[model samples]
Target: MGTVISRFLDALRFWFAAIRDVLLPRGCAGCDKPDEVLCASCTRLFRHVYRKMLPGDVGRCYGCSWYQGAVRHAILDWKDHGDEECDRPFALVLADLALKILERQIPCDQARALSLVAAPSSVASMHRRGRWQTLPLTRLMARRLNDHGFSALARPVLKLEGVQGKSVQAAGAQSRSRRIEGHVHVTEDLRGDDSLFIVVDDIVTTGATMGQCISALRAAGARDVIGLALACTPNRDE
Candidate 1:
């Protein structure tokens, strides 16, 4: 009964949001343009580029490139603004990146053995936004990857601690200066000891959050962990 009520409520809420978008028609969050979540030109701007993870890069685990430009903005809006319309676009970007990783990094057999793991948002953030952004993004990406002949599953493996803001500079400093402290908790036993797991997030800035997640997964006995983000702010070398 409770699950049914919850599902009904969610459907009602989505209906209301759809109505709101139809009536209000807000501009794009990325470029502030009219009539779209993201403009076509803006969408074209998101490019997948390789970025070297610094020594001890955490959020995106081993080596991965964060998607940038319009892709980043779309993710932020969906994540921060609770817009469901952005899911397809965000998933498209994630799928593209996943395909590239499969082709380039791991051997063909190893790529076939990997699965997608989504980082859970902090409880506070979910309460405020009313959704788990990473899960949706990961599921969408997984679907696309599956279509392209890669074995994939969305595993919610890491849970975040409550929301607490730290100085961006401080977080970045910690990522570069020292090891990340507390941030993630693993809740499940992942399958296949040899399988590579890629952790996905919407955005990564200081990498402190990702590092914490990686540490927890590593502690939980995950053999290999990789971090992937829709967008990342280049670390400021202080």
Candidate 2:
């Protein structure tokens, strides 16, 4: 009876949200362009490919936008504030980033099998948010990649253990690295796997978390690993 009641309440909430959306359409999450989830201009911001330096042989990671101003605001809305409406737009942008990375790095004909990995969120974070935020992005990316002639699968094979606090709460690169180090781990063996693993994340603040993810995959015997993020923080010189 309790489970049924909980599900009924969830359904009621969903319908209420739908009705509210129809009655009072919200402006763009990125910019206050009336009735848009993410305005065209802001969507374009997510189209630029920004490179971020990573640790070890991984060297670099790619993002769709520089995390600042409107992009940051929009992401926070979707990620922290439960703006689930932004999922579709964000997923499409991530898929576009995946294609961009593939085009620049390897020809489609020569590309290996692809695996889309959602960067792990801590258990506490998932509980707090009521979802694994990146999971939908990865799944949608896999679908889009498959539509474009790539054999891809969304694999949530990464896990974060013993992590405390949030990445946003961490101040500097060194602090961020320390927070994630020794905590990101692979849930399965990748020994002898030849697939190209792509880690999908919303933000690459310091590249430490991404580098650790790539390193963990390599340690688990993944031959090739790369990261694709929705946004990246700019370097001081940039």
What are the candidates' C-alpha RMSDs?
A: 4.0, 2.2
TM-score of model 2 vs. true structure: 0.91
**Candidate 2: segments with Cα more than 4 A from true spot:** 1-10, 167-173
For candidate 2, what is the total of clashing residue pairs? 0
Q: Candidate 2's residue-wise lDDT over 1-238, tens digit each?
A: 9999999999999999999989988989998799899999999999988889876667888999999999999998999889888988998999888888788875455356898999988887898889999999988888888888888999999999997646464456578678778999999899988889999989888788898898888899888888999999986679
Error of 1 at 25 (Å): 2.6
Highest lDDT scorer:
2
Best by TM-score: 2
Q: Cα miss at 66, model 1 (Å)?
A: 7.1
Query: Residue-wise lDDT of candidate 1 within 22-109, one digit each (tens)?
Result: 8998887667799876677766654464453533635233322344555556665776667778777767766786677667764456
